[model samples]
Target: MAVTGISANRLELLQIANAVAQEKNIDREIVIEALEEAIQKGAKSRYGAHHDIRARIDPKTGELALTRHVTIVEDDWMPEDELEEFNDSAMVRLTDASKRDPEAVVGKEYVEDLPPFEFGRVQTQMARQVITGKVREAERANQYEEFKDRVGEIVNGTVKRVEYGNTIVDLGRGEGIMRRDQSIPREVFNIGDRIRTYIYDVRPEAKGPQIMLSRAHPGFMAKLFAQEVPEVYDGVIEIRAAARDAGSRAKMAVLSNDSSIDPVGACVGMRGSRVQAVVAELQGEKIDIIQWNPDEPTFIVNALAPAEVSKVVLDEEADRVEVVVPDEQLSLAIGRRGQNVRLASQLTGWQIDIITESQDSERRQREFSERTTLFQEALDVDEVIAQLLVTEGFATVEDLAFVDNYEVAEIEGFDEDTAEELQARARDFLERQAAILDAKRVELGVEDGVMAVPGVTGAIAVALGEGGVKTVEDLADLATDEIRGGYEMKNGERVKVPGVLESFNLAQEDAELLILQARVAAGWIDASELPQPPEPEYEEEGELAEGEYDPEAVFEDVAPEAAADDAEVAEGDLEPTRDA
Candidate 1:
C-alpha cells in the first residue's frame, strides 16, 4: 500500500493540536481526543468495515493510531462461530483476553497493519464532515466550562440579535440571554449595541452554555458600585443592603469597616464620577446612597434622601417607624405617590409611616378633645358639671357615676331638691349615654349580643366607662382571663397586678380582649405573657333545693309576724336616713 494526500506527521499533528488549544483556550488533551475520534470515524467509513474500532494519540509524540477489536475463539471452532465471536457483542471479551495474553487467544485483538490507501472523492467529503462536527462539539463544551464559574460577574457584551424584545449578547466565547423582564423599563437595545450586564445565572443545555444576564437586579447596583469604588471591593467598605424600583429610583445602604473611609462618599466618588458611571449604565435611574446605621431611625432618615426628617418615632416592637417631616416638605419626603418613603422602607427593612407636622398636631388635638368629651359623656353631666366634678376629685366619669346623690348634695351651696333633681338627671343621662354607645356600636358594625355577667366588676366598669365600654355587649367581649394572668417586662420580670378584666367584672372573652387593649395601650406585656384559659366546669343540676341550701342554717329559729313588722318599720326608718 502507498500513502496519498498531505501526510500529517507526528510533529505536524502536535503543532496543529497546540494551535487549536491556544486559539480556543481549551485543553490540548481535549483537542487531541477530538482529532483521534474524527480520524477513526473517517477510516471506518473509508474501509467500510463493521467492527469495533477506537483511536488513541501518543502524548509525547502526538502519533495517532487506530485499532480494530475482535473476540477470542477456539481453534477447532467453525468459521461461522469465529465470525460470530469476533462480532460487536464479543469485542469487549476479546479485548480483555488480548490484554492478559495476546498469544493464547486465537480470535483475540491483534495489531493489524492496513494499507495507507487513498480515499475516493465521497470518502474525503465524509472525513471532512466528521472532523468538523467533532471540533465544533469540543469547542462548545470548552466554552461552557469556561463561563459556568463566571456567573454574578459583570461582562461587556455586544448585541448579536433581538427576538421578541430579548437581546442576545455575543460574549466572545459564548452567548448570553438578556430577557425583556431582566431589563429596566423604557430601556432600549438595538442590534450591535455594546452594553454592560451582570451574569446573573449560568446553566448547561444541550445546545450550549446558557448565561442569564440582567441589568435590573438590585445586586447589579451593588456590583456597579464595587467596580467604580475600590473601597467596596476591598475590605474597607461593604454594601449592606439595596432596593430598586427599576427605572424610577433606587436606594443602597453601605457600611465602612475602616473608620477613615466614608461609605457614602466612597460610593459617590470624587465629583460624583463613581455613582455617575452607575447611573449612566442604568439610563439615569436615580440612586440614593446612604450610610447603614445600627440605629433604625438614623438609617431611615438617611434612606429618605433629598428630604430632611424633623423627627422619627420608632415602634421597635412592631418594626415600624413614623417619620415626621415639616409641613412644607411633606410632599418632598413622601415623593410622587409615596415612592420615596416606599424605597426608604425597603432599604432600611422597616415599615415607614410618613406624617407631616400639621397632620400630627391636628391628630393630638383631636384625641385630647375626644378624651374630654368622653369623660363628660361617661359622667352623665354637662361640660360645666363635669368640670366641677373633676375639680372635686371626680376626674373620671366612672368616679362621678358611682357617687351617691346625698354625697353630691353635701357639696357647698348645693340645695337638697336641686341635688335630687341633679341625681335623677345624672341617672337618666347615664341611661341615655348607654343607649348612644349601643347605637355607636351598631354604627361601627359591632356584633349584636348580650353582655356576659362575669365581665362587670367595679374596676372593669370604670375602665369600660373611660374606654367607652358602656354596653353589656362590650363587657361580654372582653378577655378576663388574660388580665388575670398578668404580664412581664422587657427585662423578663413579671408584673404584679389584680386581673385587669376581673377588676371590670368582664367575662372570659371580654376580659381577655380588655387585657389585650390595656397591654397595647401601656406597652407593658409582650406576646409571650398571655396564658391559655382552662376549660370551664359544667354543672349538671342547675338549681339547689330549699332544704339543701340551709345545711349551715338548719337549726336557726323562724321569725313571728309581730317581730317581722317591727323589723320592717326599723328598715323603713333606715331607708329615709340613707335617702336624706
Candidate 2:
C-alpha cells in the first residue's frame, strides 16, 4: 500500500508538469527542468544552505532524483570572486579529496543520494516562486521564438484590454500591443473584440517579447489587398508601393506581370467587390489604385489622380519634382490641406511641388528674362542675339565658350565667324569674371589652398570666404548640410537654413564630394579614401561602349516617349508595352 501511494504521488508530479507545459505552450523539457530547479531549492532548504544540492527528473517516467555533490579542485583553487573564501562544502581541494580517494582528480565530483523530505511552509513558498519564475522565463522564450520572424505579417487577435489609449491584443500564441499612434484614427476596440493588425516590429524585452502591431502602417493596407485580391496573393499583380492618410484616403501602386491583365482593374475587382471588402475592413477609407510605371515621372502622374498634370520637371539629384497643372485643376491636384500631393509624394518617393499653369508660365518667363539679361551683359551681345542664344538653350557663358563650335554655328542665322566671335567673347568674359572673383577671394582672406582643392571653383572660393570658411581646414570641418542647405524647426515652424553654396544649388552628393576634397587638401584624409563612383554597366559586346552608356541621357530620351504613350492610352488609341 505504501508503494502504491508513492507511485501515485510520482505520477501526480508528472501529470502536473505535463499540464503546465500544455497550458503555457512551452516545451515539456523546459517544464521538467523548472520542476527540477524547484525541487533542488526545496532540498537545499531541507538539508543545509551550505550543501551543494542538485535535482533531476526522468522525462520518460515519473521519477525524481536529488543529490548532493562536492567537486575536487586543485590545492590553489579559490572562490569565483578572488576576495571571497572558498566554499568547502561544494568544492574540495585535490589534496583533501585524494586522502578519501587516491585517484581523485580536479573536476571529479563525489555525489551522495539525498532522501526525499516534506517541504516546510517557507520552503514550499520558495519552491512555488522558483517554479513560477522559471516557467515564466520559459514562456517568454517560447513567445519570442514564435513571433520574432513574423514581422511584416498581418495578424488577427482578440482585444485583451485597453490601457490609456493603447490596446493589448491576445494573439493565440502571443500578446501584441497597438499603441495609440499605430491605431487608425477614430477606430476603437472593445475588450473581446476581434481585430486585425500588422506586425511591424517585435522586440525582446526584459519583461517579455513586445509584438508591436499597427493598423495605420502602409504595409497593413498592402497586406489586406494581398488577402482580398487573388492576383496580389499569387504574385500575378504586385503592390509596388502604398501610402495612407488613415481612415481618410490611401494610394497603392500595382504592376501586373501578365500584360493581358490591368493591375488597377484587377485590384478594383469586378464592380469594386475586392476593394470594397478592404474598404469595409478599414472603416470606409477611400483607396486610389494606380498602375505602377518604371518611369518615375509617369508614376507620379498616375499617383496624383483625379487631377491633370501638364508637365513634370524632375531634379534627380534632389529627388524633387515640379508639377504643373491647369489653373482650374490646382485645387484638385493639391487636394484638401495638400493630402493628395503628400500621398503622391510618399507613393512615388519624390518631393512634389504642385503649381498652376499660370504660376509656372510666370516663373519660366522670369527665368528666361534673367538668363537673356545675363547673356547680354556677360558676352556683350545684343538683346536679339542674347535672346536667340537663350532660345537655342545657351544659359551660361561657359556653355557658349566650351561647346563644339559647330553646335553654335549650326544655330539659325549664325555663321562660323559669328560663332567664333561669340566663343571668343564668352572666353574673355569668363576670364575677366574669374579675375574679379579671384580678387574678391583674396580680399576676403581665403587661402589659395582652398581654391586648389578639387571641385572648388573661383566663385565657390569667394562664396566660402564670405561665409567664413576661408581655409581648406575650415572647409574640411563643414558638414554636408552646411554646404547643401537644410531645414530646421524654430518655434514650431520649419525654416530653411541657407547653405554657404545655396545659390550654386549643389546636390548633396556634390557637397559631400567637395568637403571630402577639402579634407584631402587639408591633410585630414587620404585621397584614396574618397568614395569611388560605380563602374557604368554596358550592353553585351557591340551593343554599346562602356564609357558611352549614360543612364540619365537614356532615361531622358525614354521619358518623353513614355509620356506620349501614356497620353495615347488615355485617348484610347494605344496600349502600354512596358514590362512589369
Give all candidates' CA lDDT scores: 0.66, 0.84
- TM-score of predicted model 1? 0.52
The residue ranges of model 2 lying beyond 4 angstroms of the native Cα positions read 1-8, 46-51, 78-85, 485-498, 537-580
For residues 158-218, what per-residue lDDT tens digits would candidate 1 score against the true structure? Answer: 9999899898999998889989999999988888999888898888877877889999888
lDDT of 1: 0.66
The window of 10 residues in a row where model 1 has the poorest summed lDDT is 566-575
Task: Give the Å shift of residue 161 in candidate 2.
Answer: 1.8
The parts of candidate 1 lying over 4 Å away from their true place are 1-16, 46-50, 59-62, 71-113, 117-129, 184-192, 269-274, 306-334, 349-580
- Which one is best on TM-score? 2
